[model samples]
Target: MKHHYWEAPIVIYLFLGGLGGGIFFLASVFDLIVAPGAGPLFFAPVFFALAALALGCFFLVFELGQPPVFWRVFTTKTAIIKWGAVLLTVAMICGFVWWASYLPLLGWQWAAGLAGLLAPVRSLMIGLAGVAGFGIMVYTGVMLSTLKAHAFWATPALPVLFTVSALSTACAAIALSLGGAVDAAGLGLLVEELIREIVHEVDIVLVIAEIVVLLVMVLSFYGAGNVTAQKVAARWVRGRTAPLFWGGMVGGGLLLPLALYLAGAGTAASEVVAPILVLCGGLLLRYLCVYSDERAPIPGEERYYERLKSSDTRFMTAWKQGENKY
Candidate 1:
């Protein structure tokens, strides 16, 4: 493998992309089934989820090599792509505004009173924005998977995998933030109860699925027998990227979370410790994936092949001329 650096912009792009897409998807799912009369209590998750998605998008735009070029995606005559981009932009803005007005007061004395008044309206907008954001999140995965050069991320499963990981990470973030708030308010028992009831079940399932998908992905690379793919897999298993693949991504993100959930299910001690440990592990995975030096090809590999048309033409002409003399 060649020595390639994973620059800061690329790292930010990976992290923000996953974080934003995941939060948006989770919020959408919740709004669809849980919103109608779940009360203002539900909004705690909704508001924070949207805020995280918004912050992720902010980082994405900030990391762009040419920030001004981003505007061109909207102005261009490309209808399908333009519409998707426009929808994401609109949803992000609306969701951010809503979250800003709601999340800060989750622990306030008058939170229930304030949310009681605004719940219906907030639920409606949150649902609409969440749906649109889900599409955008999936689109981010498609954008990466389309790149043929980086075989590691070229599989159709990349989008689905990204979606799952994103959702899991967002859930971890919510748990952590809520835990911190609960601790500050001296309500540690309530926090522990919440973890047992909510975080344990949902995150356990998510982590298990993530681990399975990761294994399948790695195995597929080994079976394919492509040199480039094999090289990428080697990097993941033993080279510079090993820490991310093993320690941060697997150990911290999936294994640790799964162990905590198992411990909590079997004993009382884990009830207090599992969620906190899982939250830290998830954040560490996010940071590693963002900062790791792994380069997957962009969506324009075909364009690179197209750009070498002259070389192909010369080779074809020489072969034809040589054969004609015989």
Candidate 2:
């Protein structure tokens, strides 16, 4: 009956938040900068980004135990969770509006009318959403790093790692959906090829950056960290968590994708297989970080908790409210 403060819901929430945020940010770059007049090509990714943000919010609220009062997050101005709520809300709203601005290109007459009305503020919404999206990507890591009790999470390198990973995965997601969206928009093969080349090239750099950062974080902890951090680093290095960290994350996630991008370049291996692996690695990164909640226990704490009956039994079931017979 091992228990931790954060669990699966939090993990999913973190992963989805970064992913959704990254997608929105990259979508903005593609639409407004990289390929202007190509807004129609981004409809699918924007839709998926909005969905991911909504789903992540749902999971966050579900994990709170008291869903009815989730709005209380806005009441506290100083709470980190409050900042996250605000960023997520702003990103989703602006992102949806930005996405809607291109509906006319999809042959929706009703949407065309609505989009015309939205034209004036379209660029503003996209810019705002991009700012908020970047905020969410950084916030996920900062939230964890701020938890000082967890030796493994409280590090400057974490936010950097998460941000790089977020952008990398976002590129992968965009690559996966680019072809279909291009066909839908009739944007032509030239545009699609240009966008695909840009995304794949960017992803290669990101994967390399992630590998370096991850190695530095682990090796630093193993070398100079405190007792708990060293223990967790050991688990990731030569201990039980080694296989997944080295083989799955380092090999399959980073190096293999790099090789695929360089060698396979334009083939399905680079476009499809590599991106999927990058996504899996992104998810695995969050899963590992969330589970690395091993705190440095105080003296006598372990023995005291081990001897407590409440640790093994449900305290509420020990007695009924009015059934005391003593």
Candidate 3:
């Protein structure tokens, strides 16, 4: 069986982390700047962001196998994973608190006191979470790019691609959940519609940016990168991963969604169908990138591994101890 260094868990963790970070960042923009008096309108998105971050962290720890070993990440200051862990923790804590600040709106008497206590510093907490969330979105791609051995991943475009995709997906998520979460009056309903419209427009731009960055990254490697990178890029361009890359990501993920958003604008096709496709594309991007880890092997390494694979399995078991038990 062929072994993969990073598996589904890592892909999931990266996707969820970027998504959560984007949601938090956008929520902060809406609450603190876009509509300060309408902070409660974003309560649902913030909650979803917190949940995503928490689940992403859980997957990260679970991927470590021995979960206790996850603590070792904080013991090192220079490691990229260490910084990611810190950012994730900070984003989660602050996001949770910010989300909690609106609990009284649910008519939960038990949460009224907690909500009141957090009301004073709610904006501050949100600001902190937004910063940390942005960091997490960038960190996901930066972490992959830092692995210099993997020629396909050590590129500048990856970070930009991931960030843009994160924001786009987050915008979609917010648009999907924004209406249901709000309990506003006549004017408030108008503001909600305006926010949804803004989100749709912003997502269209983000999707375009993601397409540009993704193509630049892949085509650059395919055209002029080293042998290892070229091989990986080939897989994405016209080889095994081509269908998913072109069909799932480019066609369905980017172009179709863009078309839907443009045609319907803020209608169900744009708000519902397009956003769902964007999210799926975002997840597929992570899956493809994580699996495209191609390490440039030293001389003779490839042949050596091939020889090992072809070697007779019985040869190893054929040997016995000095007792001649064979």
TM-scores of all candidate predictions against the true structure: 0.68, 0.92, 0.93
Better of 1 and 2 by TM-score: 2
lDDT of 3: 0.88
Model 1, 202-257: lDDT tens digits are: 87788888788777876677667366667666767787778877887788667876
Residue 202, model 1: Cα distance from true site in angstroms:
1.8
Q: Residue 309's C-alpha lDDT in candidate 3?
A: 57
Instruction: Quote the lDDT for 212 in model 1.
Output: 84
Number of the top candidate by TM-score?
Answer: 3
Cα-based lDDT for every prediction? 0.58, 0.87, 0.88
Model 2: residues >4 Å from true position, as ranges? Answer: 1-3, 182-188, 309-326
Give the higher-lDDT candidate: 1 or 2: 2
What ordering of candidates by TM-score runs from best to worst?
3, 2, 1
Ranking by lDDT: 3, 2, 1
For residues 1-326, could you state the per-residue lDDT of candidate 3 as single tens digits? 12257889899999999999999999888888987766788888888888888898888888886898788889987889999999999999999888888887776889988999999998899999999989999999999998888888899888889999999989988987884555888988888988888898899999999999999999999999999899989899999999999999999999999999999875789879999999999999999999998787778887887787579445545554334335
Which of the predicted structures, 1 or 3, would earn the higher TM-score when compared with the native? Answer: 3
